[model samples]
Target: MASEESLEESKKKVYRKEQALKRTAESLEDDEEIELPRKRYYRQRAHSNPFSDHELIYPAKPEDMKWSMLYGGSNEAPTVADVGCGFGGLLVSLSPALPKERILGIEIRVQVTQYVLDRIHALRKQNQGKEVDYTNIACLRGNAMKFLPNFFGKGQLKKVFFCFPDPHFKLRKHKARIISPTLLSEYAYCLRPGGIVYTITDVKDLHDWMRSHLEAHPLFERLSSEEEESDECVKIMTTATEEGKKVARNGGSKYIACFRRTENPK
Candidate 1:
């Protein structure tokens, strides 16, 4: 009886392993469909450590990056980056507003980034003949925290948006929150003097944390409430992103903190 029971348990374990493998296969199949063109063209890399695979997404130098390929051979480089752009809502809304300025959205998730790419492709096709071409905006899969400087030249960016960023609420995970001292230094390096860093979140603790860090950073100075209110981009950022819309629907309060890159560290 003991030997029979042992055999039965072993069989159950094997069955469970088979079920897990089946689920994993199904997930991979779904991912393949979603990541079609990218899966075919680009080599896949681990999402956790973006810098580990240096050749995956970024060019060696910002100047070496082919903006033309993405923006229809336009010589002008992107002056704005929407970090962690999910579903590309903010980029879509900002495209019409800043008709001339090139904008790039960097997202980490494979399927979400692919969805944004497809969304942009559809929008561009829809408005092919219109005066306002969305060729100014593009999306790419990137880990912004690790590879920000890899993409933008020093003082190349005029605006950086951190709209509804992931709030790493745990005390231990705060370093991953994206607005750290080290990351702020990188942000300051990429942003032109007097350029803006716009941040907003529905999470109050996260908002406070971001504000305090920016305030403490020598290179950044907090924007006055009036100045923030006057900026058109702020308004769009507040209402444009998917997170922003969800916050609005739920009547949740959003905390905004805008900072300017100073000419010299204070």
Candidate 2:
């Protein structure tokens, strides 16, 4: 019973959807080279996220990023990584303020990753080491969930940020959610003793979920409410995530949680 115009519109919509799927498939094909080491390679094959043309950069491997070797120090500079670092907001915004020597912004989207790279390049040119150095900031376009081990060793990172990640709200889709017991282990593994994980979400349920998992994890201890507030990096996280801005514009409340990685129980 639909009108002729409505039927035509539906046909066009179907065509567009098909084309999008085709493009995504092509992007995946283009990014097959960014896989991790042999043991981790098979896992990444199951989930491939691609970046666009401008998003292309020299791929990083764990061996290529040996922290101690790079700095000639037994302990590397306490590093910070922004997972799902869309357009470099968190890394670029907070780099000037952080005391750490290295900040990594990892984004899955090629176009967005490239955008962040351009922004960093521009900022570097203007600042010229006036306020901060670009040598410490780097962007990598790869699947964060899988490639995390590609750049860090056990307990190598000091802080991690998961802001405004895709809130796969459906019950069946919970596994796809960024914060899970399994993923927490990965986060904990990458974090140094006393390192911290910072997460913010507009969805109350997701917020509670992150808090519960992090709190229950034996490797982590919940940060006090006062500690979360007073923490400079936590404050930066509130403004650095894309979703945080969206939440603010809609007059929604943001739920934040922080957990400090602890030594393994003996």
Best by TM-score: 1
lDDT of 1 by residue, 1-266 (tens): 99997877686556545434544564455432221122222222323433345345777777788777777775678999999887788999999999978999998877567667766765665576798768999998888888788889999999999998878778977777878899999999999999999999999999999999999998999999999999999999999997899999999999999999999745
Q: How many backbone clashes does candidate 2 have?
A: 2
Worst 10 residues of 2 by lDDT: 35-44
In model 1, what lDDT does residue 181 have? 90
lDDT tens string, model 2, 54-147?
3433327565654443223453543888888876668867777874557888777654565565556555545554757554676767666666
Q: What number of clashing residue pairs does each candidate have, in the order they appear?
A: 0, 2
Question: Global lDDT of each model?
Answer: 0.82, 0.70
Clashing pairs in 1: none
